[model samples]
Target chain A: MTVLEARDVSYQYSVGTPFQITALEHISFSVEKGELLAIIGHTGSGKSTLIQHFNALLKPTSGQILLYGKDINETKETARDARFKVGLCFQYPEYQLFESTVYKDIAFGPGNMGLSKEEIDARVRRAAAFVGLTEPMLEKSPFDLSGGEKRRVAIAGVMAMEPEVLIMDEPAAGLDPRGRRKILEMIENYRRQTGSTVIIVSHSMEDVASLAERILVLNHGKIARMGTVDEVFSHAEELQNMGLNIPQLTGIFTRLNQLGYGVNPLTYTVEQAKTEILRYLHKGGAADG
Target chain B: MENDSLIKFNDVSYRYESDTDTPLPLAIKNIDLDIRKGEFVAVLGHNGSGKSTLAKLANAILAPESGKIFVNGMDTSDESLEYEIRQTVGVVFQNPDNQIVATIVEEDVAFGPENLGIEPKEIRRRVDDALKSVGMYEYRFHEPHKLSGGQKQRVAIAGIMAMQTECIILDEPTAMLDPKGREEVMKAMQRLNKELGVTIVLITHYMDEAVKADRVIVMDSGRIVLDGTPRQVFAEEETIEKAGLELPDCAKLAHALKRSGVNMPSDILTPDEFVEAFQRCVSGGGVL
Candidate 1:
């Protein structure tokens, strides 16, 4: 089922002014239930603007967004409910952490949902665990925690709301390797546990290659391409022409193919590259006849 | 002085004051570092690992709680020489929005030199040269707010260049930018170093960016845990992992190939180097 759909959506910023700009135009895509979608684009490619429209944070100037087959703008209640169903976590969410304690911060979303105290408490604890926050740290001030810990708490705040479609914009930005892996794992765990649809807007091709089930390429406020990891990364020349990059591993294999090695050019992940090389070695250092 | 170090830290230690009378741990402690003149150095650290503290110490943003820091032979702790030190070593921060103060690109580029009370003609010349160096001369008339993040960051670099600083320290400048923006900023930094012989101290979390630097410094728990060339530092995968970092993907692949009994070097830093080594092996028929 299409949980979220944007039908010919277009958004304009500062409309009716000399500085008016069309941020997004004629954008159309549907996200299915329990799918992990990664949106990749350069800065100011309308990735952020498009995700903002997901939760009705920014309404399109033209066309409409549908949630579960009903136009979100059909009724104010539907629009309001869409916000709850599609939680949008902005970039650098840690900066938005203003609550005194980590526990309260995570609970803020559930509390806004008007859930019972016990239900809110349960969700808060669950969300914290998903992000690997220890119980003792929950009572401490969110301000005192390390950068990685604070980012997790902020992410947990959104996860507590239990949104059916979780959308995060550059959730792992500026984090170290361990922190990045932890957050990516937390997102994967959240999806597995809730079976929720996940949408991530990121600039890291490697992260997208590793995590996303399908990838969407945005360029100049339009849909440039959309496909699975291999399908998208295989179009390396096109992406480079658009000022984008393929995964380093994929690029290595592509060069190998150009150098007369028979390795698959679509090898985007490290594991696939490893397996392909091992197979070639096992085949007596020659392409299979 | 034999190495012509531009910045030096001697037993420097810093601790942030607690907000609620609860004692906080030291931010950076007992750090000794030397940055050579006209060298491009990359700092790698997790958050709160004292990399930012080190950058601030160079430009005198934060005073050392103990010991001393020297920028261009002047002590950073000396209030009398603060202005000269800041002028000598410029710092660019992560957010492009915060660094930009002017509405227009050329105006923002000229803000630093203008603050120094330079003549109008000299300011104009510096602004034009700086903007052109960063490849942002075409966007000089555009509003800074309307520019892309990469272009805004280049403008920030141009602002720094307009100051005629000998050294530039960037604290995660590419953290908020996309890949294209990152490439742009890195290219600008490289140009600044090569063309002007400006020393660069880039602190970044991205391993790929670190590959371009002449030397890499890894920080952990307020200490210099690893310091060497990119190839040397990244070859110590276990050490990097212990410091909460990772090898660049190309290096990881090369290591994996070596581990699986392929005769490959373990220190491949960039994709191009990896391709070259793999090609040699393939053509030489060493590793199928």
Candidate 2:
């Protein structure tokens, strides 16, 4: 079932005077429930602008976004409803954490939903646990926490609302390797538990290859390509033309193929490449069939 | 000049000002390092691992509470040499949107030279040269905000380049950019280091970027936990895991293969290296 769909969505930014910059044009795609989609593109490719339209953060200039087969802009109430259903976590979400304590920050979302005080508290605790935040850390000031911790708290704040469609923009930006891995693990765990539609905007091919079941390649505000991870990565030349890359492992496999090694041409992850290489080695190191 | 190191940290120890306990929270502890002229060094650490603090010390943004830091043979503790040290080592921070100041690209590039009180003609020459070096000369007249993130970062690097500094320290310059922007910025940094012979101290979280540097330094909990060429540093799986860091995916795969009794080298930093090493192992009479 299509949980969210955009029909010919287009957006324009007015710089000044009468002139306007078209950020996105003729964008169309549908995301199903429990699908983990990654949007990859170069800067100014309109990936962020398009994702903002998913939750009605920006009204389309020429088209419509349908959440559950209903146009979001049909009514203010509907748009507001869409906002809760689609929890949009902006880049550097830690900057949006304004509450004094982490608990208050996480509770802020559920509290705004007009839930019972007890229910809000329960939801906040559950959200914190989902993101791996400990009990002692909840009462402490958010500003006092480290960068990665603060990011998790902000993400929990959104998770407290229990949105159906979770959208994250570069959630691992500026994080170290361990922090990046921890956040990725938490996100996967949350997705498995909640089965929400997950759309992540990122630049790292490795991250996208690992987490995204479907890859959406956005170029100049248009739906350049959308397919499975293997299918998208197979168009390495096209992606490179759009100023993007296949995963580094893919590049290495391509190089090995060029050097007369009969390796599988469609490897996206290190494990796949390892398996293919080992298979070739086990076949008496044959160069070709 | 051959005997003199460009930058040296002698048992340097730093603690944040907020901590009051006897054993303060050390940002960097007992760091002893020597950086020669025109060396390209990449610093890797997870967040809060003291890599940024170490970069700041090179330009005197932060002083070591214990030990000494010498920049171009001048002690950073000497207040008199602060200006000289800062001018000798320029810093480019993470966010290009935040670091940029001027409306136009060329003017922003010229800001540093102007601050150094260079002559107007010299400033213009430096700015033009710097912009050209980073492949931003064509965008000199364009509004900086109108440019792409990668272009803006290149402009930021050009600003530092115009200062005519011997060393440039970039603290996660590509963290805020997309993969293409990252590629552009890394290429520009490599070009600056290769062509101009500028020493580069790049602090980054991306293992792929670190693989290209001549040397890699890993910091953890305010300590220089690992330092060597990328191959050497990435070879120590236990050290990397203990530091709360992940090896490059290729390195991880190599480690796994080694555990499975494959005779592959454990220090593979890139997919290309892994592919080459595996191919060689198969062809060089290795047991399957």
Candidate 3:
């Protein structure tokens, strides 16, 4: 089922002024239920603007945003309704953590939804567990935790609402390897537990390659390509030309193929690359014979 | 070498006064560090590892609770030398949006020199040269807000360059940028380090960026756990991981190959190195 869709979406900033600029033009795509999609593009390439339209945060200057095959912006109540069903966690979410305690922070979203105290408490505990926050830490002020822990509080705040579709923008940016791993692990766990559709807006190709089921390449306000990981990543030269990056492990394979090594450039994960390179080495580098 | 060192820390220790007063107050423990002139150094650590604290100490943004930091033999703790110390060491923080002051790129770049009360002609020459050096001359008249993340960052670097600061410390400058923007900032830093012989102290989480630096410093729990050349530092895979960091994917693959009884070097940091190793293995006289 198509949970979220953009039909002929277009947006312009400062329209009809001397500084007028087209931010998005005729952008169209559909995201399925339970599918993990990563939207990638260079800075100011309309990624942030495109995500905003999904929840009717920014109505397309032209074009319709469809939720469950119905226009989300059809009415004021529907536009407000779409916000809860599609939780959008903006970049650097930790800075938005102004709650007194981690538990209260996580409960804020559900509280806004008018859930019962018992239900809100249950959801808060569950969300905290999803991000690996301890019982004692929940009582502490969200401001007192480490950078990684604080990030978890903000993510948990969004997850607590239990949105049908979860979208996070650069959740792991500026984190250490362990912190990043924790966030990635929590996302995988969240999907496995809830089977929710996940859309991540990120600039790190490596992170996208490791988790996303499909990838969307955005250019200067348009969809350059949208496909499964193999389809998008295999066209390494094309993505690079658009000022994007492939996974580091994939880049190695890409370079080897460019060097006449005949290695498979579709290798994205480290484990996959290890197996392919091992096979090639044991086979005397003969890729096909 | 000691005499030529631009910044030296003698048994430095810094403690952040947390509001909650949680344990682990020491942001950086007792340590000694020497940053020499014209050296390009990369600092690697996860968040809360005190790398930023070390950067702040270099220019006297924060005085050490204990120990002493000296910039150009002038103590950072000495209030009289504070201006000269900051003039000697320039720091660029993570967000370009926060660092930028003036509306226009050229004006922002010229802000430092103008603040230093340089002659109008000298400021004009320095601003143009600085902007040109960072490849942002074309965007000089453009609004700083209109430029891309990378362009804004380069403009920040140009602002520092206009001050003629001998050393530049960048704290996670590319963390918020896209891959292309990250690449652009790295190229500018490299150019500034090479062409002008400006010392660079880069604090980053990306292992790939660290590969370009002359030296790599890894911190864990507010202490330097590993410090050496990129090759030497990355060779300690276990140590890097223990510090809450990971090796670059290429280097990790090389290590995996080494563990599986292949003859690949454990320190391969880039795709080019990995390809060369694979080629060697495929050409025989190796595991096959």
- Global lDDT scores for all candidate models: 0.89, 0.87, 0.88
Candidate 2 residues lying further than 4 Å off, grouped into runs, are A15-19, A258-262, A285-289, B1-3, B19-23, B128-151, B285-288
Write model 3 residue lDDT over B1-288, tens digit each, in one string.
678899999999998776655655789899789989998999999899999999999989999989999898999998989999999999998777789999889999989999899999999999998888666898788889977665787889789989989899999988878887788778878988898899999999999999999999999988899999999999999999888899998988888877888778787988888878777776654463
Candidate 2 — which pairs collide?
A: none
Q: Which tens-of-lDDT digit does each residue in B37-123 have in candidate 1?
A: 999999998888999889988999899999988887898888999999999999998778889999889999999999888999999
Residue pairs clashing, model 3: none
Please write out the lDDT profile of model 2 over residues B1-288, one tens digit for every residue: 645588999999998777435665788889999988888999988889998889888899888899999998899988889999999999998778888999999999999989999999999999998888676898898889877666788899889989989999999988867766688778878988899898999999888899999999988888888889988898888988898888877788787777766788877887767777877776675444
lDDT of 1 at A118: 99
* Candidate 2 lDDT for residue A107: 93
Ranking by TM-score: 1, 3, 2
DockQ of each: 0.63, 0.59, 0.64
lDDT of 2 at A120: 92
Which is the leading candidate under TM-score? Answer: 1
lDDT of model 1, residue B186: 88
**TM-score-better candidate, 1 vs 2:** 1
Ten-residue stretch with the least lDDT total in model 1 chain B: B279-288
Q: Over the full model, what C-alpha lDDT does candidate 3 score relative to the true structure?
A: 0.88
Listed in order, each prediction's TM-score against the native is 0.96, 0.94, 0.95
Candidate 2 lDDT for residue B222: 87
- Model 1: DockQ vs. true structure: 0.63
- Global fold similarity of model 3 (TM-score): 0.95
